[model samples]
Target: MTHAQTQESNHLQRGLKVEQKKILDTLLQSVYRQEGWVFFVYGSGGIGKTYLWRALISKLRSENHIVLAVASSGIASLLLPGGRTTHSRFKIPFALNEYSCCNIDQGSDLAHLIEKASLIIWDEAPTAHRHAFEAVDRTFRDIMQLRHPTSMEKVFGGKVVVLGGDFGQILPVVKKVGRADVIDASISKSLTIWPHCTVFKLETNMRLLQRDGKLPAIAKEGEDEPMWINIPDDLLIKAREDSIDEMVESVYLDLLQEYTNPTYLQQRAILTSKYDMVDKINDHILKMIPGGEKVYKRADRVCPITKTGVNVEALCPTEFLNTLQLPGIPNRELKLKVGCP
Candidate 1:
């Protein structure tokens, strides 16, 4: 381990939450015994899911143990000490299906790493397809078969695996599919993997507790018949014509003065479900910044196809394509200003 890792481990070890420590202890015990326990830790945002993961990763690595830390996405992987995307790490097939297995060959370095790993931490497991998990599990058993004769019968080749994420936030993305298909792609829906897995919940919102020293009522369960969550007056914006102005002002106070500060921008964000609402919020904030604005128009073009395939570009008009505001697709026009974060 490097000096930075040692320092981080030492720092994370301190001020551990009781629940976090308990989960860490249980996972560490499983690693020590070489028990291939499939565990999933579920928690909402600000509940210290990542915090617990860092602690577990640090604790294991401090003892000279090999930990394969991976996440479903690149952004998530950056949060871990030595994390990589599961696809990049395991060489999982792009077009995942029921019978797919990872591209890891037996006796390879990655196979050896899988064999010697004490713990495998997969963050954001809920966002990945069930096939991805199954593929890795299938590969693990194949590589570890040399050591454990009945590895095929075991989950993840008797290697301790810890999966963590918030299921409430997002499910697996089954493109152009209905809600049922998306749900079906989730790891929880896998009969093979879900049955043997142990699930843990982290209910405490550390961010909320840190702010007011009082846990939010929503965090508690089993209330009387009528449940009510009280939102503070300051947190609520009035329903008026200038409500957007009020919302932006509250979240981004002194926007003109702090527009250039990356830290200030990173600390604050306004989330809206609708694309138009996002544009409204962004436009409101952009107008506040004192600088010349630049407008970039979208150049709508269809993806290339083979000679036998139909020409989608000729069939779809550029004007109609520009108007399409679908999910994961950028808007028709992007407005930016100098000094805008």
Candidate 2:
């Protein structure tokens, strides 16, 4: 048997939770029947959303159906099978506008790949701009309908697409814009696509607590009794005036002893309001990790003020742009460096 067959064989040995199995069954049915269904899996940081995606991918791929696994960020994409950033996989324009559509021609190789795709899975989708989704919708409608005239008026050209992410966590990114701007750019605010999306939410935190951090397991009195995990108050902060020490102590008190554990760094994180504070925490963590470090530096340069280039205007000279610092992005205007780092 081939690798796909082997993976399918392995999947048969495992089972899914009742809810997950239901969602998977529905999605699989849509692909098999060629139904134009759109779904949204919404959940907080954890809750087995990624786990379900993996199971779905394995099952679908095993059946010889093409699945496109994508994510809003490069890091999240690494978790999915044959995953790529949505922008990269779809050829979405970096500077998206209301009229934007993916640069995919009807008879092109990319178009063929899309035509063959049975399902599209996009994770951490809430972090992407609304225009990006619109661009994809427009592209899919134009392309899929060409392959099947019956899909001419469908939302996504009779394709089944699953998008997932936590809207409460990170809304779409709006550069140099305020909170209102970011809110306005969310997929939820989209007039075209969001209304057609069916939403699913995962509530339980499936990443069980570390042994020391976990609460005592309660005895189940009945089959109908609900299962829950209680977190200790000491591990939780009480007041508005934040105490980083309390959180650090609760989460990483054993960091020195558990330094060698590969997942130690990933399990423990310290979020701060300021970038400088992050720098300080990073330095402390590096020192704690038993290693000598080497630092590489970037060489930055400024182009000549000569108006020689095509449609060149020194919009706020390089000197003025370098001094401003913003929260998330560089406060200064990005410098035009001569070479790559």
> Which has the greatest lDDT?
1
Worst 10 residues of 2 by lDDT: 332-341
Q: After superposition, which runs of candidate 2 have C-alpha atoms over 4 Å from their true positions?
A: 1-15, 176-178, 208-341
Candidate 2 scores a C-alpha RMSD against the true structure in Å of 10.7
Q: How many clashing pairs per prediction, in order?
A: 0, 5
Model 2 accuracy (lDDT, Cα): 0.77
Candidate 1 structure quality by residue, lDDT tens digits, 44-93: 87889888888888878877999999999998898888999999999999
Candidate 2 lDDT over residue span 1-341, tens digit each: 37867666367426566677777788888889988888998877767788889888888777788999999999999989799999899999999999999999998999989899999999999999999999998889899887688666777777889999998788886789999889989898888889989998776666642332346655466656557666776556664454555555566878767756767766666677887676555555555555445554333235645576643235655555555455765433222222211
How close to the true structure is residue 278 of candidate 2, measured as C-alpha lDDT? 64
Residue 220, candidate 2: C-alpha displacement in angstroms: 34
lDDT of model number 1? 0.87
TM per model?
0.72, 0.65
User: Clashing pairs in model 1?
Assistant: none
